[model samples]
Target: MTTPESALPMVVPATDLPARVRIHEVGARDGLQNEKTAVPTSVKAEFVHRLADAGLTTIEATSFVHPKWVPQLADAEDLFPQLADLRGIALPVLVPNQRGLDRALALGARRVAVFASATESFAKANLNRSLDESLAVFDPVVRQAKDADVHVRGYVSMCFGDPWEGAVPFHQVVRVCKALRDMGCDELSLGDTIGVATPGHVLELLSLLNEEGVPTNVIGVHFHDTYGQALANTYAALEHGVTTVDASAGGLGGCPYAKSATGNLATEDLVWMLQGLGIETGVDLGKLTATSVWMAEQLGRPSPSRTVRALSHQE
Candidate 1:
């Protein structure tokens, strides 16, 4: 079989990197939540199925937030049940409060995430609550989910830099991260919401989190590509022994509050690098590119991912 020049890269394994990495795919949820015009419910379902078919194991299905807040996901009630047919895939949904949690639990969702912010400014802007107040809101949500034996992911956004409060100090982020760990979060994702983080800054935060008692195994990195440093920052995280990564397929979404912020690190771009480095992510580059291209058609825009554009014939 001939490998398409666009499809394959030579594998060259390196030392000091994790043998395998788990990509926390957020395309179906994070990628689509900000669309000005919501994609159809059936198309959203098909996108998730295609992502799973392309070997992404962990897919964030959707958010259960109220329609008034994020009208894009108003179909959560109708959509969650459609995904039950998928087997052996971990479908996690974002729950903003007790009401969001209740709706998710009622739909039989076993994995859920509560998004928090490392800076007070972002918490106030994104959740319309103070940093501590937002955590307070999630405390019972996490506790109740734990009581039900459900897995919880705590997302600490604006971990590196904040638009309102620029260059957030490491100590501020540490406090928020520690709070989530103490609240029984099974895993934590540190987010560079403004896409301003450098490789050194990323390594420093991961090292500090380790010293502060947050193990690398339970921590994932979510980087934005605004400054074009996302891949560099991610490489630094991998060198520090962090394996799980959060990426948006085709590089779809950005911080709505931060106008300068770009999309999340593209999954196609990440997979191409992992494949070249011989890191096993279990993501099929060919099929994943095709999925992104198909999704791009749904949005009537070309994908922003360099790798997707390079590898996809449809694009």
Candidate 2:
């Protein structure tokens, strides 16, 4: 009768932390998209539903990129409508272009995201366009989504480091962020795509963004665990008054376009930290870990989340 919360961290309240944090759950879309093989559309739908049941309010459901570009999430058309009954939870889908946006909007997707990069190399590699060109591409997509009364989230990748071009400049990251904000994105999610961010670097970039007119309320942080700094960076963000975080359940996925990127910060692990800090996340840690455990079983592999393994007692 062991429960996941049996080993929970002692909640020591942090005066600087936000009263509540919104976790933008990405396991269903960003996580599963990296899978070598696509799970069935039914499985994908269930994963999203299970995540909601676990108290994840913002679940990234799927991507609307063309099948040729992302075969795993090609089921965006078949999968989104299945979650029609999931009221009260936000289901965001990645819409890579105007066409992708069309597909998402047609299926009644109210929340959509567009991916951009801060480095030219990552832009060329991931989007096959220069940084400026990539921004131009998203211009119409973001415009149209906003026009349709849809919520648009702009994801700025490689904010900290780029494998092709090491250690990005703070101003360069801020420029792309400004462009997204100017282009009418409702909010921005800064990505530590390569997981090379430290707390100082995270804090500095955040300060620059704030200086450049991006309000703390409209900014979210997405970090990878490659260097094991995701949690520390997240704490830096929380200390900066940022409340939105991007994490995946069971630490299931990485950036499919960036080979150097690793799994995202695990929701359970982040929840553990937030819970320990006595910061409210509204996530049921036990139910969330159990859901990840169930998903790991379906994937035929152990979850990479340390918290999940510890709670489930897996080696």
lDDT of each: 0.92, 0.93
Q: Which ten residues in a row have the lowest lDDT in candidate 1?
A: 1-10
* lDDT by residue (tens digit), candidate 1, 204-226: 99899889998999999999999
Instruction: Quote the lDDT for 80 in model 1.
Output: 93
Which pairs, if any, clash in model 1? none
Query: Among these predicted structures, which one has the highest lDDT?
Result: 2
In model 2, the Cα lDDT at residue 204 comes to: 94
- Model 1 root-mean-square deviation: 1.5
Screening candidate 2 with a backbone cut-off below 3 angstroms (N, C-alpha, C), the clashing residue pairs are none
TM-score of each: 0.97, 0.98
